[model samples]
Target chain A: MRERRIIAIASGKGGTGKTTIAVNLAAVMEGPVAYVDCDVEEPNGHIFLKPAITAANSVAIPVPIVDKEKCTGCARCVTACRYNALACVKGRVLVFTELCHGCGGCMLACPEHAISECDHEIGVVETGRANDICFVQGRLKIGVAMSPPLIRAAKAASPSEGTVILDAPPGTSCPVIAAVKDSDFVVLVTEPTPFGLHDLTLAVDTVRQIGIPFGVVVNRCDIGDDRVTDYCQREEIPILIEIPDDRRIAEAYSRGCMAVESLPDVRPFFLQLDLRIRDLLSAPNGVQSAT
Target chain B: MKELVVVSGKGGTGKTSIVAAFAALTPSKVLADCDVDAADLHLVLQPEIRSRNEFRSGHEAVIRQDACIGCGACLVNCRFDAIRTVSNADLAWMFGAGIHACNDCDVCVRSCPLRSLDMINAMREASGEARKTAFVVDPISCEGCGVCVDICPVKAISFPERVSGEWFISDTRHGPMVHARLGIAADNSGKLVSLVRQQARQLAQDQNKEFILVDGPPGIGCPVIASLTGASLVLIVTEPTLSGQHDLQRVAELARHFRIPAVVGVNKWDLNPDMTDAIEAAAVTLDATPVGRIRYDRAVTAAQVAGKSVLEYSNNGVADDIRNVWAAVSALMQLDKPKANREAP
Candidate 1:
């Protein structure tokens, strides 16, 4: 049996080639692999992978639906809610579905049993296949404020026993945390510039707090200075791979083409990356630093 | 004051770079970096910190282990599954048992006929003591909803405000700038973004600046919404890619939903000119004006690496493109006319 590993490619700063690395890595992997795009707000993996849609599942969360007939306008639900999802306007209860976290606190607090739960569609989870690899992505409904639930739905649709590569959203906030957490290993892709180094440190802090083993992969390594590599060495974090600033790769990416499939020169880099990840995971100490 | 916000629905289509260039071009402006999660405009503007303030919002539950009576109230009521149970033996291993001096009497130790001291020491060393479970709150999972704090039977849980991030007021070469940094793994960035915008408005009022230029975050989510809600105008910077077009439509819809006028600028338009034309056409249908197109330029990155805006680095190529975009945006904003003249007589 092949060892199952869930790897997340994440970059705190936007436009650092996170999806580029994720799709190319999936293209180079052998056998049955799963690719999950957790960047629900702006998912780009579909543009590169061009997966054929086999199924689409609408992801919804439970929001409070008030039964006015059973009502005593006690305002308990409004007071109990921490998110300001419920309001008492002119002795009537108003539900702001967008503000609700869907925690069901309002339902639990309703003394008159007036609050009931209803499914509120926030996004859709689409499942399909791109060649031998199973592909899943979350598309958040336009104007939806929350994306973590949709991201979770996409991850849940992924095959449990396989090599799963999750392309995480940029930033170190809740959405990024939801996408990257629970992965066996994480690949932090970054450029070597000041913006990249700054955001990389925040991402490192996030993954370290989650207690996940991670390594760095610097994209466009030749474009910026060597501070990123120097920082990794000082922190004892492994530098898995460095992809040079290649115009061909950028052109391929802009045209919605996978680099591994379009550029022969890029294939070797991704293949080598796969080998390094497997070797590191199988090592005794793994890639986790002492800090 | 009239406000202009620059947003990119997709990540890294050169929103910050353009905003920095606009800051350099426009003199009577207050700048704000509303991308609190991974703020990078400060890198280009090189703001000198004038004041830094902590941003606190919401509350997370904290359990007092000493007061907890091993009740399951909080664990059962938490909807987020943020509560966790750990055996007392495990806690003792991690954090030592509160075994101080029992008044130095040693009566219990001496009274046992089986030599309880040896047994007690052995149990502590081997972590084999009888286990009593204690509850704890996982900070990440806790939505700071206060449900656990309210449901605890023994009132052992205390809800305290969370220090989500920090906001800063700073001085730059061009003007005063407002920005923030959301704490690692913290929530409520939308709130922080709003606070930063508010501060920028206040600073602009104080300094008598007529314009406020805001660099908004990527994605059409909470922080992005917060940045552009009441702004006078919004300029969406996007690239010539399928993903970029898809995200641009959503963000343009967001601006329209909020009733804010929007304009679009295609960055790296030379990478895929066909897609650029398609995106501009789509932007028009979405009621967004296509203002300008910027060719793919390495000088943008070069200028970023040198910590200078492209306009400041050189006045050719992308710099000229940015100047054209700014001119169109300002014309839409009617900034060439004095504020008093534009007002109703």
Candidate 2:
């Protein structure tokens, strides 16, 4: 049995059609496909996919709870905490849970064994279906500072035996990294504007640093100038597809309709993308060498 | 100075474009681009950098080879897989494995009997490991946690500030602009944003600027939270798409959570009028004012490509709509001076 290939759709800038590509590709793919929305801060893939959630699990991080009776006011945990999340007030230890990264380093530093971890809910991981496609998404609770943990939970919900497509959050940050990690290939969706070009470079740098094969998909190709194409050509980054600007497509998107469903012309593009991705993965040299 | 931050919970909704236009319109205003992670305002504003400062945030660990014996205690205690044993046999050890994953825990230095490991500088990597064996910390992956510092028996590890990224103050055609670039995959963007905002506010006050317009980062995360805190008003730019509508609600909720006044405006509102109305209704429910909407326009990208604001590049309805939107926003915030009483810039 072969391991399932995971293709991550990411963008350094937001609204570059990362979710559009992820949802439409999943809809048009040949085999059993799992569409994972790892943009926990605003998981929008479900809007296009319109998945009926079958199950949901609360995602939590282990934040330390102090036993005042057992603590000796040693202040070891406060000194050990690097995030400034813990402090000793007079005779008691105070924990600022929002600042905690859930690294569990404080638990090891306590000499009196007074610290115990408790589940602190940050979000939810939901599993569902969009027709024949398996759907999963993470929703971060309002006012939550962290998102990587929830993204990890969403990625974990991927089916073990199918093609998995992860729709990543914008920006080249922790949440984006968590979504694209361990993926077989990264499809970076971007436009041709300066913002898109600048962010595409960053996204490319991030994927290269993470040592993953990736290609670019230009969205809104008709609106912006040709600098993105020039940049990709100069950088030797492969251009997978160019999605032209179409009012019908944008209108469908605004109405929460899949492109493959509303615009027949859009189906072939994603279908071709599905094939192109398969071809890239099966090639001996991988995506970078394919160019 | 009254600060107005322009943000979008979702990315690519013209927050920077709107901010850039605002910068061009305001005569006595300083601009701060707080979207450190993927900052794009600089592309449009094309600022001439007057000052550049290294933004040092987290800490990275280092090992002193001169005082060290080769021990694997650090490798075992590292939870983040940041440490590795370096030997002459593998001269490529620095680039080979676990090179950039240090979390700044000084456990190996503490556990070492001879106390060979010292946390020197968080961002700087040590060189000249030709003869001696030592433990190396991968700076990229280090979270600056002090666990290793706590466990080191020899107390060899030292916490040195790591340069996470760089920030700049620059002169643009519009005014003085502040911006930053977070290093690839580096953390502390929220901290960097706060720093940028601080500098912009200080500059505004020093210059007697009437307004400080902020271009905020995307997502309702740490950086976004930091950008919105203490702002006079938040203008959330969004589209008419379902995702845009959904994200507008989340960002509105965040504004409510932070007790910041928010106004919502849909860019390209004509693409889906129904969704536009829906989003406006949703904004009203969240106690956010439904600001005027802007029509879809290609002038935005054309202006970006030409390195100019929409007001400078086009005279279309989209540009007119933006001006009207600004007027409405100014009126809402009571930032507008009476027409006859205002002095021309």
Native contacts recovered, each model: 0.60, 0.73
DockQ, structure candidate 2: 0.64
Point to the candidate with the largest DockQ: 2
TM-score of chain A of 1: 0.98
lDDT of 2 by residue, B64-152 (tens): 65443333455555655567555564533322222133445544344443443332331115423232446777765566776655555
Clashing pairs in 1: none
Candidate 2 displacement at residue B173 in angstroms: 1.1
iRMS of every model, one decimal?
1.2, 1.5
TM, every model = 0.90, 0.88
Q: Write the per-residue lDDT of candidate 2 for residues A42-96, one digit (tens) a residue.
A: 8899998888999999999889999989999899888888889999989799999
TM-score result, candidate 1: 0.90
The DockQ of predicted model 1 stands at 0.61
**A1-291: candidate 1 lDDT, tens digit per residue:** 766789999988898999999999999998779999999988889898889999999999899999999868889989989999999988899999999888877876777889899999999999999988899999988878888889888999999787999999999999998898788888999999888998999999999988888899999999888889999999888889999998888778878899998888889999999998888888848664523
Stretches of candidate 1 off by over 4 Å are A1-3, A284-286, B87-131, B335-345
When just chain B is superposed on the true chain B, each candidate scores a TM-score of 0.84, 0.80
